[model samples]
Target: METAEKPNHIGRKIGRIRELRGMKQETLAEELGISQQAISKIEQSEKIEEEKLEKIAKVLGVTKEGIENFSDEAIFNIIGNTVTNHDNSSLLCFQPNFNPIEKLVQVYEENKKLYERLLKVEQEKIAYLEKLMKEK
Candidate 1:
């Protein structure tokens, strides 16, 4: 069985390349003759079949091997290494880390709560400052 990491990497690559090429997910889906949802799934790193991978590679103007061998960690390293060395040509293309929908949702919720707390604190501080100014 393929590890979850692999698909995540492929999805991120698809997203990045599509963005770089100025292609929408809908457009990629059309070129691949798949649904927009399917493209979304691929971009989100959902489990996709081998044939779909081939189609994605073709549509994205990348080689099949390019898509097949990528892993999330590998892609992260590629980005990190390339930024440090400025030698993108030698960097092995990588897939992104597996980020499931559930995980994303959870993270979103956590962030939302944190943001809310920050806002409350700011409001409280402003109220205190305003009261002090009024008293003065």
Candidate 2:
């Protein structure tokens, strides 16, 4: 007699992948056009319908097989190995070819532009309120 293998918790895998991607149940529900409660129920389930699973996989930007084989421990192990070899020397080095002062100036300019835009928006709101008061 052939023995049947136990199935994995596919729903839990999907939920984990969704969480790793920084997606909320509400966001997944909105993308799937379902309710948040429905999403909660799905995540709590051990199995999901194939069509629904496909939809969820697409939204989470992963293949069904990827979710099935996802392991946090494996990811951390890979990162640890990459960071520390047998000798414990660093595998990666940081060398920036660009000038730090130039980058800082660029960031400062971007922030200034954003602040100016916000100030303009506040000024517009004030002008609108003043106009409304004059009308009254």
Candidate 3:
């Protein structure tokens, strides 16, 4: 019989916990004294040595066992507990479900529309000023 493929628990759990703590990969990398590229590799489920795993667990404030064994359900429970302990202030601030790049595009489109409208308003103001000057 073929052996079942092991789940990518380390990457998935790390990603879940990091997002729950509102930490970026670069920030975590800096805290652990590792390069962001290394963090990226970890998040992407690349093989990590035992020493690196220990460092990551220390930086994330999780136990080495927790890093090694967390399932998706366990990670979700941890995230839920974290949210419950905090004030509801971030209820509105949390855009955890949205993709960052998509949000950026949305803001850009909104600003572009606002800029076009403002340009039209400015042109009208200039026209009114010219008419007033000619009348004077």
Candidate 4:
């Protein structure tokens, strides 16, 4: 009996790397000047164009080859090997302490605040312009 090998999906690799880097799709989309939906579509793709892949790699802070060669097992192995107790036993404390969703929400709140501030300034400018025009 022969088992078929699964294809290495470049898009999946890109998504994993981005997640590992603690990045959100919105952030990645903003960096690439693309829509969040576009980023979602790209992640769903099994294959991506080489030039576009290069640009994505740049935004992810990884080389294209690195994305192509990415493996979850390798990351776990590296983390497992690097961490150890004083007695020389390996400690498996691999879970991320911070929540990714929380980070994304914080960013969203910051952007909303900035947008509100800018809108207020624009409204004040318009009011000033209206007052000046009334005097004319």
Best by lDDT: 4
Note the clash tally of each candidate. Answer: 3, 0, 0, 0
- After superposing candidate 1 on the true structure, give the runs of residues whose Cα lies further than 4 Å from its correct spot: 1-8, 68-136
Better of 1 and 3 by TM-score: 3
Looking at candidate 2, what is the lDDT of residue 99?
93
RMSD score of candidate 4 (Å): 14.4
Task: Flag the better candidate by lDDT, 2 or 3.
Answer: 2
Per-candidate TM equals 0.43, 0.57, 0.49, 0.61
lDDT per residue (tens digit) for residues 1-136 in model 2: 9999766888788788888889999999999999999999999898888888888889999887787787777878988887745663443555689998999999999999999999999999999999999999
Give per-residue lDDT, candidate 4, residue 113.
100
Off by over 4 Å in 2: 1-7, 85-136
Worst-scoring 10-residue span by lDDT in model 4? 85-94
lDDT values, one for every candidate: 0.79, 0.87, 0.83, 0.92
The alpha-carbon RMSD values of the candidates against the true structure, listed in the order shown, are 16.4, 10.4, 11.0, 14.4
For candidate 3, the 10 contiguous residues with the lowest summed lDDT are 82-91
Q: What local lDDT does model 4 show for residue 131?
A: 100
| lDDT by residue for model 4 (9-58), tens | 88899889999999999999999999999999999898999999999999
Lowest summed lDDT window (length 10), candidate 1 = 2-11
**For residues 14-90, could you state the per-residue lDDT of candidate 3 as single tens digits?**
87778777899999999988889978888888456788788888888888787777676775797888776466686
Instruction: Name the better of 3 and 4 by TM-score.
Output: 4
